[model samples]
Target: MRPICLPERVAARAFPPLAPIAFACSLALQLSPARAQNALSVEPDTTAGSVPLRVLDARVRLGGERVRLPGRENMGLAGLTELLNVGGEWWVGPGVYGAATGHRGGLFVPGVEGAWSHPFNDWLAVDTGVFAGGGGGAAAPVGGGLMLRPHVDLVFRFPGFYTGPTFSKVWFTSGQINSNQFGWMLNVDSSFRYRPADFHGTATDGSATGLGFDHVDATVTMARPRNSTSTAGTPMTQRIGLVGLRAERSVDGPFWAGIEAAGAGSGGVAGYAEVLGTAGLRFPVVGDRLSLGVRGAVGLGGGGAIDTGGGLLVKASAGMTLRLTDTLGIGAELGLVDAPDGHYKAETAAVSLNWALDVPQRDLSDWFNTRPGTPTRMEFGTGVERYRAARKDGRTEALEAVVLQVNRFVAPDVYLTGQAHSAFAGGAGAYSVGLFGIGAQMPVSQRVRLGAEALAGAAGGGGVDTQGGAVLQARAYADVALTDSLSLRVAAGKIKSVHGGLDAPVVDAALVFSFGVDHKH
Candidate 1:
């Protein structure tokens, strides 16, 4: 069969509008944004140079459930989990691979996951994997609290599309008061990889090569004309060298699009990765196995790269691809690039290795999983606390203190908390007072939360009327969540000095930032 190129007029109509949400949450998980470009380096069982490692396989998921815990009523929690892991993997068989990633959410979950992908034929496949993690937390006082997830994927290989069902079990902890707490959830995601060969004029199946593929190429800029003419009036060819990775999706027709982020900063240029969005057309020449295309894009050029006011950029290019096999291929392109306010421009050319990411060619080695997220909400703040009272001998005092608070979502509208404060002002000067206690918080709205606590720790610093004595404190406050982990607070409380026999009042405010996750439901 021969691959055909669509007429320019017809190609323009090939793309149809898709829903906006269609752009997000396409898979239960995506190995990586550039999974295919990195596929060739992965091997099923090769002692290859230092085994492959995956660093920070970050994943984000939406949807949750409400469950009942021992001694507690049913709590409906908005399910949101953030994980970071460092691990290695090995291929088990023709359609199977296993990997372990250290996971952390509200609790510590570290486990292994395996996938078995069996091709129904060359165009379809079935894939399944089970993921598990175990670790210790406040609830899992002894053994590790665990998490298990099993998923199934139905894949359309030719188009590189996959979708399926996923089920998961998230555990809390095992403690003396009760035993354990956990939740169950189910969700679905779908997405497709760009198949360069599938686009109009890209190429046909079982080809030696194809046009329109994701690739990593090395480029050499042979000529860069300067604003001022040379003595001889000929443009000098500097021949600057560079390398980069390009991911594209021309899945629909002759037009393909994707992001290109590559780096080159050696030889006095300042390291920078040129990232751009591209769209283009393909023309088939010999049969359906080889084709040529032209692409145009505009984006910012940063990383010290020469750019005008805002680092504006534009690139016009022509390229060709030849498939050596069903999955392996080669490509080269010549481009006219202008950046940094169009002050810098060059005529560039380069070659690339086109590798398509698919089940049959996937090899997992030194891959990693890590990322930062607010798994729980903890705040650190600063405020001024004061006290006032009546009594012939009762004294009033004011102090500036540093406050630290930790909280967790317990119910839709409530939170459990622990707080501490160390005073640096007031009559005691430096060695003043310290307050610590447990309390509760309630969110009155998306941004505001009301709270109260009682604390008693140590009191007294150097002074004629001083000696260390027990300090008692209590307060009520209102805090507003500023971001995923930040907040601002206003509070009022009472303090009593046991040794000085005085009653004090506290009035203060603070800026707080949470270090972990907060109530989402």
Candidate 2:
């Protein structure tokens, strides 16, 4: 059965009250002097005379709210962001929000956000923020899925964290969801050291200090549904195929923590997804070459007709990892997944290829230490794209997306990129794409360059027939320098499913930020 599309009348109801709220908050942030002086401060000795890129703030927020999903029901969203201080009392960065309530599990939104914060005294402060993004899933009634959320919080400050009560409003520009709710929030403070974009040198000391993660893994998973029941109490029989990404950092001797997010790419369950927090302990069996581990995770998951009441799930696994190199490993796991409040049970097996990063951990009070002469050049950006005449469920329509990307220069005129696209228009709110590949460029002038790229990734959902979710895309782009560290880019591209009937012409525009970091080899 096909899902219902949103009503056309919701498009005209875009909220107008946000402009004043945004303006007032901006004014308050600009006039405040409370959080300006030591915004990016680190220890004086190791960071002296160094002009490195800095992570001004890293925060994780968990919140809950109730919405009108045909009836009043609870929803939870978790947020993470790495912000850079722009000026006095203001910070801006990229952030992602995902459903953690399990009731409507497949919700994911990737967006850009800004915040204003000021201290009232030594122990109390106010923080306000606004997020703009696009996404939808689980047949939710978010038309076009362009979502906006604005929030205000009053927090009690501690040494390295804050606890607060928050009030927020969530609205969709072309959808039938307008919700206001109050929730509790917790925020942690953190920082990391990095290098400048123009850095091209060799490190003398054996140390690294950029991108605080220690490891990343790409996973392919297969699950056998056991005793699973549909939302309507019907019997279900389907095997699920999922692709996922995991990132983690060590906390103590053998303990580590991380985040994992995955989506179903096959098995007729396109809109099923989960975002979870994981912790584990690893013990070496063969002196850094082989290891065994046990991991446990809990989070929200639903959608795809699997009944996960409130969307909460827990999983446990045992695995072994074999080190192929100093920086790479392969692993396999056997696990049990269960939804306590819903009728879902599964036994899963997964294989993963992982890469190791050596960035050391730094606390909120300390700065990252990078060895001099490390060479890392990169660009990060966010923008929008439009797909003309995309094929979905035997029909064709235009779709719009919010895109986030990172480019790492391997040579002066050559680079590699990773990108994500989330659909927000044309009744395709649940559709998304992830891609990685290579590109080349040359300078036409001091301010302009042209380039082309080819990429392949997995995409599904929104009833788009991606047939196992493999896709390829190629694009040509023009970039114009706006400043030494910023540029404006526009591109035209073609995207096609490898085994399905989704072929579309895509056009995009974005603003890119360039940074460089020095690290040890």
Candidate 3:
């Protein structure tokens, strides 16, 4: 998802209706000048000549509406430290963030962030940074975050070309009322972005908001090839290529707005479309040190060969970066995306602590290691399980059952497993059972893997018994990364049973094939 950015002028325009109410309250305060004076006396002095100090600033935001999550309320906190250079052009700071459901605070996350700034010749300067942290308020333990952003600007001194640095600064100088009166004050002078290849963070503003940078904008992404099937059970294979373009304007001040269009090709799915409008705002958090801001977009026109029945697509987010020392700091974000038919409705909150080392600009391969050709891997597995049937009266004796298994992974983290079982009894005829199972795997470590499964089959007399279970399996036997697409696993654990089985002791092993999304931490 992208952060939502509002233009200074637009933000200024949005203030009028709400300003009267606030101004009236401000006037009531005038009645107590003595109290106001006393308040000022106790307030921390933020003067240009004060000694540099760390200021702790945090925000708790709660937003709930009919949109997005339907009837759910979303809330989060941005805890940060703003390093002020009370007297210089360079500033830096870092902090952490966490968000959760409004009803329950049980699911909580903590993440880190950092930012830095150096003014060059007053009119031009460059800013660059990164972040890595995690925990979605909903799945705190498994959540993660990471981001990298570096940007430069050519400041135009004249109002004719560039807008002022902040909305507050611009409005104070021109004395012109605008829609988003406080819009500029809430921005950091940098772009909001993430690396898409790793799925470590959400898409960049261009991809999320359908906005562009400069007059010409381009984007491209490629994932390792694989194969899978749709929910409708259609077989599909994929060789990835994701690309797009758009038109953008470098607005004055810490803001920009544009329009964009992009397309993706993978498996049997292909689609393209144009975004309506997108905008962003960036400004320093405290002086030239820490930075924070928002960026967002809404769909406008163009529906392509693969339309998800588009009505509206929107993206919004808020982020902060802090500079800890020179090479390390923390960053965090709260983002959301909503598209037609719930195709793009995802609320994501993440934080990261990152350490970056300056590397000379080099070819793509210098940054990423890749094999000259595709690698082929194979795996074979088998396991035995026992199910002790419940004992009845004297007429029947307890039954002991055993199963044989086999599985294979056709792609990364995907598998197909098969099992056969036979039952032996002291008082009845020996009966047999068969099962075919399919599932997905997520590896957390060398000996731990998390997975969900669905299976269907019949027992003695062809009595049907279908089951589904979520497995948190651990390999008690071995530890090794077998291959890019294959993992050697030996696990034993209880699964959340979804079917009725007579106290089945699930002790079985088989080769497994897995596929689908990878949630990385």
Best by lDDT: 2
For each candidate, the alpha-carbon lDDT, in order, equals: 0.39, 0.68, 0.31
Q: After TM-score superposition, what is the CA distance of residue 268 in candidate 2 from its true location, in Å?
A: 1.6
Candidate 3 residue lDDT tens string, 1-521: 66555444443433212222222222221222222233443553422122111222221111111111223433222112222232334443322222211221111111222334454654554332232222121211221112111222223233111222221111101111111112211222221111111122221111111011222333333322223222233432433333333334445567655543333322222212223345667588777457787867554211111222222446576877575633344656566644443222345454544222221112233333221211111223333333334322313223333334433333345544443333322221122333445556676785456664454332321111112111121122332344433444554433222233323434444433211111111
Alpha-carbon RMSD, each predicted model:
25.9, 9.7, 26.0
Clash totals for all candidate models:
37, 13, 62
Q: What C-alpha lDDT, on a 0 to 100 scale, does residue 29 get in candidate 3?
A: 19
lDDT of 2 by residue, 1-521 (tens): 66543321211121111112222222222221113224434542233234433444444444444444546655565555556667788978787666655366667777888889899998899999998888877667788888898999887898856766777888877887788866655555544345556544444232223444457787888888899887778866888888777767565578776767676667766557776767788999999889999998776566666776666678899999998866568999999998887788999999998765443212112123322334446688899999864455578888888999877564566776777788878777777776777888888998898989998777776777676677789999999999877899999999998778889898999998877544333
Candidate 1, lDDT over the whole model: 0.39
Question: What is the clash count of model 2?
Answer: 13
Better of 2 and 3 by TM-score: 2
- Candidate 2 overall Cα lDDT vs. reference? 0.68
TM-score of predicted structure 2: 0.82
* lDDT of residue 265 for candidate 3: 26
True-structure RMSD for candidate 3: 26.0
When 1 and 2 are scored with lDDT, the better candidate is 2
